[model samples]
Structure formats: C-alpha cells, structure tokens
Target: MDLDEARKLWHPEPGWLNTASYGLPAEPTWTALQEALAQWRVGRNAIELWNESAERSRAAFARLVGVPAGDVAIGSTVSQLLAPVAAALPPGARVVVPEVEFISNLFPWLAQAERGVEVRTVPLEKLVDAIDDGTDLVAFSLVQSADGRIAPYDEIVAAARAHGALVSVDATQGCGWLPFDARRADAVVVGAYKWLTAPRGVALGYLAPGLRDRMRPDAAGWFAGGDPNGSYYGPPLRLADDARRFDISPAWFCYVGAAPALELVAEIGVPAIRDHDVALANRFLDGLGRPPGESAIVTVDVPGAEEKLERAGVRAAVRAGRVRASFHVYSSEEDVDLALNALAG
Candidate 1:
C-alpha cells in the first residue's frame, strides 16, 4: 500500500502531528456510518446487522494482533474492557504494575484493593523483577504515554509467565503502529481512537486461552453469551465458553468505523507499517539532531519547544517536560522537515 491510500483517508490541513492523541478516520468509516444512520432512519435497525458488524471488527482485530477471533472481546473503552478482568482474579492476589503507566492500566488493578488484593507499583525498570511466585497479575503499558519509552515488554511477559503470573497490557500507544502478539499476554486491552485511526467509543481486547479458561465472566450481559440469541429466549444467563463471554455491546457507529479502519491496517500489514513509522520517526529525530529511537515517537528536551512548534504551524505536545512529536504511517518527510524548521525557529 502506498501513502496515497492513507493520505486520501484523512487530510490534516498541514503540519498536523498530533496523531498520537487522536487519529484521523478514513473516508470509508464515514460512509459506513452514514449508511448505518440511513438504515436506522428507515426503521430497518436489525440486531443481526449489529452482531455481524461486531463480528467483522472482532475478526479484524484478531488478525491484526495474531489471535483467534474467539479470543477477542469488544468494549466501549480500555477501562471498561479491563474491569471484568480485574474482578475475575482471586481475592488477596498480588498484582504488580509499573509506577509510570497510563491510568487506564493503573486504576483498575489498584481498584482491586477493595477486594483484598494487593497492588504493588514499581518503576518500569523493576516491573519484571517485582514479579514472583505469589504474584497473580502484572499490568503495564507496552509504550509509555508521556515520554514515548517503549518498554522491553517481551522480557516482562516471559518473566510473568515463568513466575505463573498473568500479564495484561495497555497497548493504546503501540498497537496499530507496531506489531504485537496477543497470545504473549494473558489479556491485551486497546482503545482504537489513536493509532488504529478509528473513532472513539470502541476498544478491542484479547484474552489468552489460559486466562479465558481460568477467569469468570464477572460482567456478563445479554450480548456476553454463547448464543446471545438462544440466551435471550432461553435461560436467564448462559454465557459463552470463549472470549465472547466478556464481549459487551458496543456503539454501532463505532463498529462501522472500526471494521474499515482495521481492514485497511490489515491490508497494509503491521510489519510494513512498523517499518514506515520507524523510518519517519528516525528521520524526524535525525532532523532534530537527536539519536534514533525504537518506536514512532520522538521526544526532544528543548525548552518552550511545544509552544514554538505550535506557533510555527507544527502540531506537537508538551508531555513530562519534553516536546513529544509522534509519527504515524500517514506522516511524511515534508511533515518532519516542517517540524525541524519550526523547532530551529
């Protein structure tokens, strides 16, 4: 796939570099949404249609993250997706998390304290070292949101598994721009609004077979069952055996957008996407006279750089006392040039 396909999807006026905060949706997402609205206006709202759309989205996410569709769950947000996971763990279980993490990954595990579980927060460097035989869960972010630090997550995952601890990852910053295996973690939670280029209000989750078999479906609902159809008319509660048991009903419009967004990403493939983003990010770092980093995020420690870049029509953000410029598949060398010149100014 060429940049033309991505360019035609969303055109930010010029010098828009804030894609890490929120991605621009493709034209197909809009068209699909309008079609859904039209169907609703005509009183043709069908539950079957919504189910089919959600299935399409689940399949796309599974393919993207290298998991089976049966292992994927749908939710409105990453926090919402993770709440059930927190509730399902045994009481008094020791949970290890990083001191620096996006709150979505932090709060839920911390909230488990009310259930008598112990939550330990350590520095990201010591996260894996903190895990032991007594630890039941390890929750962390694959990419640090503030400073763009990509953690050595595979080592952590292996350590957790070796210690018999379940690992849950908040992959919001790293999911679409990079390739990751869902099977590596017990659970992987993601919000689609950022790197995935879908709208807000939809998140994708993956539960590994081991975790899926062990945890109870604490938040099971009408749609969170083996046959939502048979469950609707049969027993009061008959949940599915797979990850679908954790699936919640999502906003239909979000699914309309997500299906196309994920399909496009799948067509482009994450390997190619990672290479493209890394190249652009390295170019941006080099342009700023900084060393190359591993991921698509480049953070410069220049004073007042965020405001200066903004005034120069280059979009960037100040996070943790550094100017963070996040590159994506849609970013071009021209965008980096504009940003470098603006930084120099």
Candidate 2:
C-alpha cells in the first residue's frame, strides 16, 4: 500500500509511543479485534467450533510466513511452544545460543539445564562455531532485541544442519518486519504481540515438516487430543501428528484477534513493510550528525544518555558516543527531525 493509504489505516493519536518492542499491527487491527471477540464469545466452550476458527487462523499465519497451515501450531506464548522442543532433546546435549539473545530464547534452554542438559552460552561468534556435529540444537532470535541486529539465518541454518543439529528460532521481533522462511528452520516460535499487532496471549509455532513429531508436548490439554468426531473418549489424550499437538488450552480470543492484523499484513506485503521500516531507520540514522565512523545505531556511549533522549521524546540507546534511534513504519519524518534538532540544540 502507498504511504497515504497506509496512513489512513493507522490512525495513531499524537504522542503515542512507536516502539516495536510493544508490537504494532497494521491499521485494521482494532476492527479485527472487535470481530474476534464477538466470535470467541459465541464459540466459548465449544471445542469443535473453536477448532474451526483456530485452523483458519493457522492458515492465515502460514500464508503470512510462507508455510503450510499444517505446520503451524497456535500457542498462547512463545515459551509454551519452545518448552516441548527443549524437553525432547537428548540429555546432556549442548544447545548453543547467542550471548545477547533475548531472555525468551535463553529461558527454555536454561530450563533444560535444570534437567541435566548442557546449556552452552557463548558470544554470537562462538555460537556460530558451536553449531557443529556435537550440538544438539541451536537456538537464537532472528533479530537481536537490544540492538536490532539481523542474524544471518541462512548461514546459521547451514552450519546447524551440517552437524545434524536441530535449529529453533525465536522470531518475535522479526516476523512482521522481516521475511521469515519458516521452512528453513526445524522450528520457529513467535508472539503476535510484538510485531504482528495481535493481542497478547497469542503466539504461533511453525514446525518444519518432520519436526512436529519430534517434540514431546510439555503441557498437553484436552484439546490437544481427539478426533473431533465424538468417537474419541476423554479428549483423545494423544498428541496430534501435526503442529496442533503443541497447543495448550486453545485460545479462541487470541486467534480471533490475530486474524485481521495478519490479513492487513498480507495485503501490504512484508517486503514493502520492511522497506518502509528501513527507510525510517535510515532517516533516524542520518539525523545523528556524526562522522561515518561513529554514526552507527546502538553504539553511543554517553552518561545518562538514554534518559536524556527519553526526556527529549526520543527512544534511543547511547553507546560509544553514538546514538541509536530505532524507527518503524509508524514513525514519521518529524520524529527524526525532532531527534536531529535535539542533538543540534
């Protein structure tokens, strides 16, 4: 969609925060959410009815990420999905993760450490190296949350697969803004809250074709089992063959909330969204007024600098005398201009 059309869809009030950390969906999110709530109330306590909506939401997500619907598992949280994969790993197996990964990616493996699994924490460079044969699984975020550094997934996947290691990605920060090839990894988990603009308590897990069968469901609820045909007794009790087996306490509301947001994203196209975000990021970067060597985002180092920027109505990180201003599709040129003028002042 063109900027003017896109602007009408997103009518953010002045002074609203533009942090992608909280997640931002396309303009139709509110309308979509209202519809979702209505459907959920109508289907409450009806398993078969709810599954229909859930399946539809899965298909929507699958299309968004370019995967088959069968590979998608709807979850309420990223941790819920990652937990199963972590439990299924061989005991004492080393799981390599980046030193700077978000806590969501780290906690699941840390839980494994409590179960006698070896959690190997290393810098991003070492994590890359450790994806060799001895590695059981390698987990990392597609984008580093703190600095917005995009990880090279192709390289990481190539290294992991060469060693026969499974690769799991926490794509929370990258999904709506980046092109995510879920088919490229063993499994990828993401929350709709951050980038997808869906309500909280809604997340998704996309398991590569054969990987679904490998995960031992960590918290299997009644909905996880059953044929939905009534012949099955006591909720079937067996995990599903598809990614749906990973779901716990099926959330119809979250499913509903996600529908419109994803629909809008599909309409806009992810590549177009990325281009807009990158342009905004560039504008913010150029406003720094520093020499090329020190113009990098997230590298500024001034005392109490982050607070100062915040007071100026700018969100940024100061490291090594450089200021890193994160920008998103909703961020206007005026935002960059303000930050630049503040630096000049």
**Best candidate, TM-score-wise?**
1
**Deviation in Å, model 1, residue 316 alpha carbon:** 2.2
| Candidate 2 lDDT score at position 321 | 50
TM-score, predicted candidate 2 vs. hidden true structure = 0.85
Give the CA lDDT, 0 to 100, for residue 60 in model 1: 89
Per-residue lDDT of model 1, residues 72-149, tens digit only: 999889998888888888999899888878889888878888889898889998987888999999998888888778
**Candidate 1 residue spans exceeding 4 A from truth:** 2-6
Give the clashing residue pairs of candidate 2, or none. Answer: 23-194, 299-319, 300-318, 300-319, 300-320, 300-322, 301-319, 301-320, 301-321
Candidate 1 TM-score, true structure as reference: 0.94
**RMSD of every prediction:** 1.8, 3.7
Candidate 2 on 1-345: residue-level lDDT in tens? 564567566654332234445655554667656655675679645555545656766777898888888788888888888888888887788889998887888888888776688888777766677777789889998876666677778889999988988999998878877887888899899888766777788888898766766667767665565443442566336666677667676576666667776666666777877777677666655566433321112344445655655767766554335455555556677766776665555
Instruction: Assess each prediction's global lDDT (C-alpha) against the native.
Output: 0.84, 0.70
lDDT minimum window of 10 residues, candidate 2: 290-299
